[model samples]
Target chain A: MTEQQTGDVPSARPYYQPPSLTGRPQPANLADILERVLDKGIIIAGDIRVNLLDIELLTIKLRLLVVSVDKAEEMGIDWWKHDPMLTVRERGLDEENRELRERLAQLEGTPDDEEGGQDEGDGSARGRQSAGSRSRGDA
Target chain B: MSDMPPAPTSADGPEPSVPVSDTATNSATNPATDTVTDSSTGQGSEQGTGRYLYAVCRRLPPGALQGVHGLSGEPLELVEHGDLVAVVSTVPLASFGEDALRRNLEDLSWLESVVRGHDDVVQAVAAHGPVAPMRLATICFDDDAVRARLRQWAVDLGYVLDRVTGSAEWSVKLLELAPQAEALEEAEAPASGAEYLRRRKAAVEQRAASSASAADVADDIHATLACRAKASRQLPPQDPRLSGLSGTMVLNAAYLVPDVDAAEFTAALDELRGRYPSLLIDARGPWPPYSFAMLGQP
Candidate 1:
């Protein structure tokens, strides 16, 4: 098993050159091009008048297509996490965790067993709601 | 048909004369014509050619668009009204007429090719001098109608050209970092129901606080960059899928910076990147000023 895995690494190396290594202008991504040409620019009425609302809806569809296709390809690879430029420092996480714990303690006070059960239900429900709303804003 | 008189030929004679002779011959052969016929709806009746306007330039350096092709792979030509020159190419009315355009714009692949082709010509003209790009699929019946639009919108076109002459557009987007997986595992398992609730509540509050701070950082970055640019506009954040990156986009903006100030604008960006190491500051530019070329009216 170790030998097979080791052999696979050499084969994959040729196919996966990072874009920055090429030292060329990365072709503008589809989303960037679509947003500029469709959503921006001077709008002079022409002989062929395309409905503005139709263009807006088409842009929305293209955005969704770009997101879903790219997202599926990125699912198992987690490529961005490995990018050196994107690697965030770990120092802030520890400090933030400490602050959060202290605030949580202050909010809960001395908890009883019965109240703890009720608080858990409410907390989890609120967490779900916040997550739902955040995703809604992105859409 | 004789009433329209040979669509005012340009001073240079040869180039504008091609369209002049073509329209004259067209008017003579295709005599199913009337003075009051609506050009937009008369697409099916004539089955003639239409001019696809790419961009209008202040003055194109001689032969700037030498080998560049337009949307239909047709050789590009210049339609000069006065000092203002319109970059155009002949497209068959069959594919580019009003009805055909309505159907074609809905197809994704067709739209992509046309958009790319339009940008290619705009970029070619922009390389030489100031260019005000037309909206996608702005076609006219013939050279006469093309000249008519230039005559009418001369002032606004001049204003757009003046505003974008020496500058280009730059895009800057800031994305917040998603929490690392190991960080979530750092906290030990909860001892009781109360502990679980405490952790959950803390997680929620932490998320809200961080997003708020990220928004502030985005605003600060925009303000700093805007000071270096001549003009700036904040566009709505793009979807993560389209951007091909994860994490919420906090700032999606376009800045119109003079050519001389480009270095200073980028330097400011580098400084901001260092200040907010947690953010992904994606900056790309010197694009044709698509966001800033709007005439006051549609």
Candidate 2:
């Protein structure tokens, strides 16, 4: 162990070494990994340890909070943007938007089937709640 | 091993053994102070002895840790008790003193920074060799206090080091999402109440099956990787908020793999990913052996 910031040496002491040595290499087993993840590992609790609360609440408190983004939007709750790391399923929307724009551009070339294509496109748009439809509709 | 009869108390200081103060902070009050007074008659007189605390262990090679400052920029000291070494620094009695710690520990940020700093140091030490990290918020009032603890927990500490000797931790997460498009399609499909009920039941059964499958896969992943590593241990699943991770965490498990088979464990995870598409498996690590330092010798 290096004692940083202390150039002043204490009284000359005998070099010490612990009798217990643990540097031997071993196989990576389930006991080791499970212990690593669940039992032994660095536990960092910050100003607000939000991440650790989920399991504690669900298991010990027996409380479940399932707030849908759609419902929250209706209630004027803006938790979606609070932490981008916790949000999922947004990629599907982006993929949908690209497909819709591509279809619209393809439809732009045909004049005779304008009304029919528009209706079909509308049906497809209603059928899919993907990002593509949302983006095209907003546009 | 013969107890070296409390290393002849050096003439420089009383009870100068490093172990006394190494873990003095573990008690509710200073161990030395506690032993001096009992509440039988409400006598609170103390023996006026200070303490030293062993926070985190980060192996700073022989010379890498020469200038690192502790919690308050105090000079840090190293107390080597065999192969395992403890990095210690003196904390003012006010911060760690019996009355003050109880009063101030509730301030979450202060406690967090101290714990994190402790962990950072431990990680550094673990990088070099197997480190038996002390629990969170362990302190000692004196060198004698530390040695008393060392004497008390020698066997426990040895066990902890043996379990983590050559292992590294890895994290794997599983997430599942019910696609909006699929839900919309089902809603739009022309069907009777009976058909709708059947569909709902099927969806429930599918969810159950998926959940069971995820568990099996997690177990399999653990088994496959365990074969490559020396030892492994499991941790409770964490919440998304605590983990700072993306997606609903279906399976959040960490594995301790040997340094020699680290690549093999990762490759197994990749193969597991390809084998299961419905459930997303994101793997990270080869991290320091943090999880292996369970309750040491005491």
Candidate 3:
């Protein structure tokens, strides 16, 4: 076994070496790491049985924590909007009116629906419409 | 899934006879012992030190993890069963126990550190050989229990290692760029209520068209790259808030590419970048094959 000194940092703490020295990319964002370690991997059950349901709920909480309030609002993640643990703030009149109008548009099956229907001819448009509406609902 | 190996025994090992009483005696005598001991009761039967399994790999060079530490700076140890080696460290039952983990996993900072620690070890092991990473916080009561798992799952583990050998996972995300200032200006200041509705409808149509084309571009990009990869998986797009990136993430994908094809794969990515200048193609990796290490999923 050829032992290579992968740690290049001059610090006395060998384990704290910069990740670059090992040729590994810098530590990815918390979301990326959590997604992989929590959601992916070889799940061989061990003696300690952690509740997977709790972990799933925790993942959702982390997702909410990481998302910016404005972006979460844009995505229509309203679970926390009224949660007692999270701040409950009134929506601005303009924002409320916009949501009402968008809901009305969907109900009316207006021009937006027509454009969406026409775009779905190729089968990719419906996904795009939902994704767009989720993020760019005001538009 | 039916053909997959039976899920490894949880809590109940093949040898329930492995003498938990002996472990309790050892923990009492050795203050630093990793045996699970119930803190509240100061007894070993209820709890003792659990071996936190980070990953399993084949032929890890002796001392490859010399200076590396496991979660909570615990010194790592290797438990070998045949050619498979489990990289593990002792975690106290106080925190790593099932109840403790349930609470700790909810704390973002705790989860973040553990996740990073897990990745760091996986990366260190991957530097030597292919590693099959364990999900967060997989623990065995003792080395015997760990070996029981290793013995039972050896075939599947070997299969996973074989599949991931000489390959790495790469993350590729495609984001749609924000609309130009001119486009935003056009939607503002409608001359009349009729014009306002018209502008709103037009804006919605424009967004729909742009998003549709962006989705097409994303698909094309994934297809072009997937051709160069050994295996590919499209994960859900991450939230912009978590990624600290602007614009809509249209595609989030992981590709397992052999080391030999890495250069060509990157070249293809560069070419795609030039072809779709409007989309932000965020590519990162050569990471441990986290996405491809599944035993039966392949």
Q: For every model in order, what is the iRMS?
A: 7.1, 15.5, 8.1
lDDT of 1 by residue, A16-94 (tens): 2222211123566666777888888878777656677678767655544432333312222232223212211221233
- For candidate 3, write residues B6-66 as lDDT tens digits: 1123344332211112222222123243223333331233245677889998866656776
lDDT of each residue in A1-139, candidate 2, tens digit only? 5656555754222321111111223332332232333234333221111233332322221111122232233223333434323333332233323343334432543434533333232343344334323232233
**Candidate 1: DockQ?**
0.23
Displacement of the residue B294 alpha carbon in candidate 3, Å: 1.0
Q: Candidates sorted by lDDT, descending order?
A: 3, 1, 2
TM-scores of the candidates are 0.67, 0.52, 0.70
Q: Give per-residue CA lDDT, model 1, range B1-298, as digits (tens).
A: 2332122222333235132222224331133532323454445533556678889887676657767877766667667777888877766666777677778889878888888999999999899888898888787765666777888899999999999989999888887654642254357888975576565545645655776788899889999999999899987656554566456567889999999998888888889978988788888877899888988743
DockQ of each candidate relative to the true complex: 0.23, 0.04, 0.24
Candidate 2 chain A: worst-modelled 10 consecutive residues by lDDT = A57-66
lDDT of 2 at A21: 17
User: Taking candidate 1, what TM-score does its chain B reach relative to the real chain B?
Assistant: 0.78
Give me candidate 3's TM-score against the actual structure.
0.70
True contacts kept of each: 0.44, 0.08, 0.54
Quote the positional error of residue B15 for candidate 3 in Å.
15
lDDT preference between candidates 1 and 3, better one: 3
